[model samples]
Target: MTRPIIGRVAPEQWRSTGATAPGQRTVGEPGTARIAVDLLGGDHAPAVVVDGALRAVQDDPSLHLILVGPAEATDAVFAALEPAQRHRITVVLGDSAVRAVAEGRADAVVSAGDTAVTVVSATRALGCWPGVRRPPLAAVLPTATGHLVLLDVGSTVDPDAETLAVHARLGAAYATAVHDVPEPRVGLLTIGTEPGKGDRLRRAMPRRLAGLPRYIGLVEGHDVVLGEAADVVVTDGFTGNVLLKALEASYSRLGGPESTRAAVLLGVKGVVVVCHGAATGADLAGGIAFAADLHRRAAIAAIVTSLSDNPVLTYNEVSHD
Candidate 1:
């Protein structure tokens, strides 16, 4: 069986730095993962961020959080923590959070602010993989059948034909890396399964994605719910995000998965997760866990390797080009 890394932090020196929450100490353990939380990125700002950080520390002994935002908010989080438990938490400025990952200060980043800002900051800070022009956000949804991979959930809204093709490659690689699915089947999301159903972008993708990886023909909205047509489903951000939210709402009404709050930012240099802008403490906690899971599994690195190994077909060389 494939033994995936499920979010274990690395061993590092424990440093209290500067925290005045009574018994504040540092619990730096070997294999401890330090996550940088974006305090001002969510709708609720510092309040939810504070609650989530505390919950994360309480749930995992080896987890540490670098609260990134205004000092006042982070201080509030520290104030609420018991002095002894405070050792596991650190407060970093928001501007420094992305840099912390690039500078080797944090293992992963979770943000719920403007999706565009997070994407830009992460891409600029962490950098995108080679040939990854438009990075896609890949979300994992639990279907009645099984877990499904959906890409471009909130990134690349105005993607071109080439961009959709690139997302297909990234999604397939992600499935192989994280889902451990060999030769992952890819499906292009369209309004209907019939030929020429979607706009120009969708029509152009099938021909390009074919023969690259295990590209299946066009799949409709129902395919995403069924989870049988493809292991990785590709769509533009506008459609994907709306569909995801609608489905999530439906699932909430009918009661599907217990938790659905984590999504990996694919095509970037490092692992990053974008949770719901209105995520609760528990939802944020789930995002943290998901980020950790990706880090341990080396999902992003593995996907990069796969993409490199199997480069996308050049423009001129493509069949319909």
Candidate 2:
């Protein structure tokens, strides 16, 4: 499948992408979180979204939800919560939830929609950080020893070596900022750790990553499962996305995947979380919680501060790899 390139789209055009909605309640309180959710996102959208929204409200007492989608879907959310529970809930009737983030109507945004569409919406809405050509999706998973951070997970499906290198920096910063890991050891995920093995992108990455913080050369798939290899692993979106899905599936079949089902969209200026298309009610709820935590922790701003001095990935022959 051809991946959606991170194009330079105007905010007006980006917000023009439409969905159904008629509006519902509008309320906000102190300590309350305002998250704009794509009502029509995911395979079993409105239903699962409604379930997730309701569950999130139940889980987080200070949480406030902004349901964006069809009027019917928003109504479902209203029906689930009582009059007292409705005080923290608001309704926006549209698929333009990303616009809420851009306009500062909400603190963050969550979607289980098309990865390309969601990425385009957020990047167009919130803009990208300086020197960030491609905004990769970074997912944190539980490893055997500790936790692992994987980048380029379905955001930039086909990125160049430099893009992957940039993602390495972004992923490392993410570990340091959100995961609270100091001096994260970064690794390039490829078929082999041996020098001169794997594809052109993998071969070119070591040199670029060498300049970044705590880079430990190449790492393999098993390294991602075992926390001993590296704290952060960078790969192309195609490989990262495939690996994430396969692992999620395998873990789910055995019992269930990690509690956090959402992948953080890194390299963007605002807080945006992307849940898998197959995400269930619980998974979507987890995404909502994850977004709320990032907002509260100011994860994006913290990551920028952590990577302030790192050299941006420079384009060269690696762009063609």
Candidate 3:
């Protein structure tokens, strides 16, 4: 938290003047997935963001960027790419990049911005799913077995039992749709699996999530790394966010199994990926790629469909706080 978080973008002036590069529409350009990026986000923003955007466009032939920030910051991105390549870039001078997706100007949004700001803007621009007041940021991690999904990494802090239950639904749907797991097992993360081991919120979650057939009882923190316990692990945002950072740091220190340094914001209408505020250029680049991949796979739609089809999930509409 070294850098003070830049103030959230105001609603009326969020949309600013923009520039579009001139060039012929390359093959698949028209149909290419466009991602809106928050250039002013992150601890070392604009510079790191510009670097990430440049890398993303260069690596993917059909990838297009809708960068939102100051003219000076975007100009840097414009300077790096050739005039011909500018056709792939569109600058939207605004802090609310997620608005691009809500407006249908972009397929997805990538931000290393403050979690609360991104969540608020995303929810306002693209309303949450029915009965979902708050969404979870699901981070997919590599584990001993295969992969496990941990949610609420930095989204709803102080989530209620109901919110956590909804995360279970979201995480399970995500595992099924994105991971192609036929029946994604879900576990409530806590200090121990034994009954009455977790905090007040976790202790209350079991009853609400009981209807979920795939609920595989409780899981410890180690389940997140082991992956053998459950495919989806649900926790409150406060704990999830702290644990995620710890795991990332530990992995960095150990130089072990690598996972994308991005988390997908679930329960939203459009694709939104959020990276750590301290993310490096490569990490941000990976996020852009992750957003594009999510859009390509139609992951959100699949999760929605899976959620709708699950009678257990639909029936359990726990009251929101």
Candidate 4:
């Protein structure tokens, strides 16, 4: 089905309307964040999503939701909210929550859907930043000292050196923009801290990361957990995803600081947060809050500006042996 073209609205021209026209952009009052929630995106759809949406709206007074899913599911959300609170929600009557952002109906999107689908939809609808072939999902994990940014957490599984290089820059920029880290340290995750310890991809990374400032060389798995070595850890999506899940499980069983179950899809034009398929209502709510925070901070735009301002971060394709 061909979707209608939606005209983009300038930030200054944004206004709130009770009902949105096709392709007509709507914005809430100042300081209001409109987040599009995917009601059917998780393993436990509507039920958990409804709970999460209600929780988010109740907690954040400035939040407005554009619920996207089946009528019955979205209706569940509306039914749960109070008569006055119901005014904060707008229904999309479709599955793609990312589409709401692309159409300027929402400031950000939160989906627990398939990672591949979210990545593809975001790339197609919102578009990718320059030099980004495959956008990487960057998750922030609580480290011993503070939080660290981990990238390619299930976005690009079989990435080349150039892809990881792009992710490294993205992760660094994300750390600085979101975490307020100064000259964030970027590290390549591998089996050992030694230079020649990892596989072909790890071995090829040093050359690719030549000009990245504050890159402190190869970091081991412990470095990711300890947070002593680097502020941003870069790796292939497969490895990063597995590591994040393992850590989450460990934190659940043993007593430790919890890792974030949701990740922000970087290198894309808009703020899109992805939660795990089996995410709980609390997790989904956290993801929605994360999206709202990023949107409010203008984090994506700041990251893009940081990248554009830094001459060293420009991606250059190099032949890998």
TM-score leader: 4
What is the model-wide C-alpha lDDT for candidate 2?
0.77
Q: What is the C-alpha lDDT of each candidate?
A: 0.74, 0.77, 0.81, 0.81
Quick one: how many clashes does candidate 2 have?
Answer: 2
Give RMSD to native, each candidate.
Answer: 7.9, 7.8, 5.7, 5.6
Candidate that beats the other on lDDT, 3 or 4, i.e. the better one: 4
In TM-score terms, candidate 1 sits at 0.86
Residue 162 of model 3, lDDT score: 80
Evaluated at residue 133, the lDDT of candidate 3 is 87
Worst lDDT run of 10 residues, candidate 4, spans 9-18
- lDDT string for model 3 (50-100, tens) is 788878888887788877876556555555656556666665456588977
Give the higher-TM-score candidate: 2 or 4.
Answer: 4
Give the lDDT of residue 24 in candidate 3. Answer: 23
The estimated TM-scores of all candidates read 0.86, 0.85, 0.88, 0.89
The Cα error of candidate 3 at residue 169, in Å, is 0.3
lDDT per residue for candidate 4 within 1-321, as digits (tens), equals 122123332222212232453566676457788898887889998788877877888889899887777655544554565656566666446758898889888899999989899999999999987678899999999888988998889999999988898899889888877888757899999998776889999999998787787889899899988999999999999999999998888878988896657999998889999999998998998999999999999998888767766666643321122
lDDT tens per residue, model 1, 13-43? 1224532111333332455777777877788
Leading candidate by lDDT: 4
Misplaced by over 4 Å in model 3 are 1-31, 315-321
Question: For all candidates, what are the clash counts?
Answer: 10, 2, 0, 0
